[model samples]
Target: MIEKRAAQRHRVFKGGTITFENGGIACIVRNVSEGGAAIDLDAPVTLPQSFTLAIARDNLVRNCRPVWRSDRRVGLAFVQ
Candidate 1:
């Protein structure tokens, strides 16, 4: 396999939330970079194309869009 990421991802294990109009879902950030993040969810749920990723402990919130998904994990790209 070849590396295709624009930026290098750093491993992380932080609790966070995925927020949208209706409500929010709890998740764990597995990895992160300036451009995107990998989040681990509790279950397989329908997520919007765009949403907010709030990492309160880090005092950070990023607007994001889903780039990929698996059973309980999602890859997100930060939206400008």
Candidate 2:
């Protein structure tokens, strides 16, 4: 695959929350960087076009849009 990220991501194993206006789901943060992150769900899920990713352990929350998705993982890009 061609590298397209503005910053490089590093491997991680943190817990995360994918939250929308109505609800949320638990996820595993597989990798992360300043610009974005890759999170794995228990299974493939249909999420909103935009949502917030909350990593309580890191005391971080970012608004993001899905850049790509696979069977269980989603690639996210941070939004303002």
> Top TM-score: which candidate number?
1
CA displacement after TM-score superposition, residue 62 of candidate 2 (Å):
0.3
Top lDDT prediction, candidate number: 1
State the weakest 10-residue window (summed lDDT) of model 1.
Answer: 41-50
Q: Could you give candidate 2's per-residue lDDT for residues 1-80 as a string of tens digits?
A: 99977899999999999999989999999999999999999988899999999999999999999999998999999999
Per-model TM values vs. the true structure: 0.96, 0.93
lDDT of each: 0.96, 0.95
- Model 2 deviation from the true structure expressed as Cα RMSD, one decimal place: 1.4
Candidate 1 colliding pairs = none
Local accuracy of candidate 1 as per-residue lDDT tens digits, 21-72: 9999999999999999999999899998899999999999999999999889
lDDT of 1: 0.96
Off by over 4 Å in 1: none
RMSD of each: 0.7, 1.4
